[model samples]
Target chain A: MTRPNLQVALDHSDLPSAIKDVTNVGDIVDIIEVGTILILQAGDQAVKCIRAMYPDKKIVADTKCADAGGTVAENVQKAGADWTTVICCATIPTMKAAAEKIEEVQVELYGDWTYEQAQLWLDAGISQVIYHQSRDALFAGETWGEKDLTKVQKLIDMGFRVSVTGGLDVETLKLFKGMPVYTFITGRGITAAENPAQAATDFLAEIKRIWGE
Target chain B: MTRPNLQVALDHSDLPSAIKDVTNVGDIVDIIEVGTILILQAGDQAVKCIRAMYPDKKIVADTKCADAGGTVAENVQKAGADWTTVICCATIPTMKAAAEKIEEVQVELYGDWTYEQAQLWLDAGISQVIYHQSRDALFAGETWGEKDLTKVQKLIDMGFRVSVTGGLDVETLKLFKGMPVYTFITGRGITAAENPAQAATDFLAEIKRIWGE
Candidate 1:
């Protein structure tokens, strides 16, 4: 069984706070996502600074590019992003342009998509899929509902790498213990904690306990 | 008989060039969109700098937000964006959160939609609709087809503040001249020219000639 990777989503609007959390918990994080707000707030420097600090972990730029595919992809890749996200809502051609630009830099593409657009993205050769449970749903005390899980299952069944995000916590993660989730992207659950390192360590330990390393 | 506003889409990856383009063409341009690449490369500081430099024109942060509505909206608004864009592909509640956040800051929402999602966006009260032409389609030498124009007509009939973009130039602006396009977003046609001011002037002149503004 493939153990799910643990990705830390750094979404701080400023650089110092984001760096502090990464410094605290970098060891346990298998991947780091420079979240949409951070990218919008700090620019490519957010990813570059994080990459310079933690070159070992994969850095994902959550630019959520809806247009200007070549420029957006190259900017993020040149800033040292190993992977970048292209929103599925952008046209198939736009998505393709983004994917091609990332390819030029030898970086991977993570298609942030809804279920209806799954087959189309898959057909376009998008490798990884991010199934985002809306933050509103998470804040409203929603669980990882059965329908969302079913989509995850379908994506996994379709032979795609899948990551799940949206206020993920250790308790909710345990529900998919044996599933092949490529990554569990947690932001507030880890970075917002009193001790970020300990929170990340706990999350990693829980993953290992269930998936047996 | 409302005249379509001329918008300079600043998509430079850095500040100086973007500022230069605006300085050259700011007179004819009614709105200035800090494009996605500029936002990703320079942060909200991009918008703030442009707003400070060109205070008269409307400033838009083309964030194309894929998630985390509150933070993205707040970040752009704080940076002085008069409007911000949200991708229609994000979940409905997520889109609403973005819309509400922008409204809270007294800024407007530019909902970037694919045709299929138009009615849903309108029903959800997304005020402005951007009919983006994929950059890829333009590169493929594709003209704006009837299908695309039909949606524009439909949205205009439905009373949406519709903006048409995708490599719009002086020639194409004539096609939609008599139509009530709320805005025409032009990037390279003006910004990439040897004389950006002249290019923009020509575009504005064409618009005025056709619409008799």
Candidate 2:
């Protein structure tokens, strides 16, 4: 099994904060996700800035695109995204257009699918999936529980290149040490740290230690 | 009967094109929508720029936020969106958080619910809905047919502040006359024309002629 990469999520509402933190962790991070909050707040200028700064790094424009699939997919990829995320509920037409656009651009598309919406990937003919842990749920008295781990295993068993995210920290990451997630996404986990570089380096080390990458 | 407002959607892939087109029609447009393509390609900078230019006009961030609802709602509104849209499939937790944030900021939330998902807005305590016409369907030889119009009437009867969008041109706008649409969103309908100002003015005039605004 191929080990997953550490994708640092820059969810900062401000462009400078995200750029400052991304510069700190860029050496250790494998994928840089310009998160939905940043995308909605900063726009493609963020994509341009990040793309210019890291020409070789893989970047994900997490648009959570629910509509206007073709136009968004074509343009975001043109703006220099290696991957773009579509929401779980996109229309079949949107999904089909997105898949075609991704292929044409030599990029990839992942759907943010919930348990009930798992079938959407099959319908969309896209295999990559992000099994998100809701931050609202986390703040509303729920912890990342056993079901989430099992869900990850289930998605892997079902032949998905699964990605997991939700306010992940070092302490919480121990739970998925040997799991077959294709990507481990961290946001405030590294960005909020005093020394983001040290924090990201530690995360990389931990991933390597756990998965023997 | 409340008259519908002319909302010019800036769906351009480049920020400069959107800015220029919006500037041409700004005086007549009641709402300036940072369309999905603009939002994904330009990020929140699009919203900030338009907001700075038209401090009095209503701006829809059109994040189409499907997850991390609270953070997106609070920040986009703070970034100067008069309204933020959430995908119909967002989790209850996301909806709850978004509703609270929009209310706290004294803005609005519109849910893009499909036919079956119409009740989600009521469940989320949001009154606005968008009966989106999928472009994929249009390309696939599926026109925005009668079922879509009926669905609009259904939503209005159900007491929703309904908005309709998707490749709306003047010919198509004539079809929705006397309907209870709260807002009519036009992107290429105005921006794609050789004379975008004349196109937008025509749309505004037609709206008044049809709805007696």
The global Cα lDDT (0 to 1) of model 2 is: 0.76
| Candidate 2 residue lDDT tens string, A21-137 | 899998789999888788777778888789999999999888777667787777778778888887766666767787677642111222234544455566457777777777776
lDDT of 1 by residue, B1-213 (tens): 867889888889998888877888887789888988898999878989988987767888888775677678878988888788877665556567777766421112222344456666677787577786777667767668777788788888876888898878898887785588888888998999889999988988888888778
First chain TM-score, candidate 1: 0.91
The lDDT leader among the candidates is: 1
Against the true structure, what is each candidate's TM-score?
0.93, 0.88
lDDT, model 1, position B92: 56
Q: Judge the docking of candidate 2 as incorrect, acceptable, medium or high.
A: acceptable
Question: Candidate 2 at residue A37, lDDT?
Answer: 84
List clashing residue pairs in candidate 2: A41-B44, A42-B44, A43-B42, A43-B43, A43-B44, A44-B42, A44-B43
lDDT of 1 by residue, A10-66 (tens): 889988889988998887789899988888899988989999998877888988776
Fnat per model, in the order shown: 0.58, 0.61
Worst 10 residues of 1 chain A by lDDT: A104-113
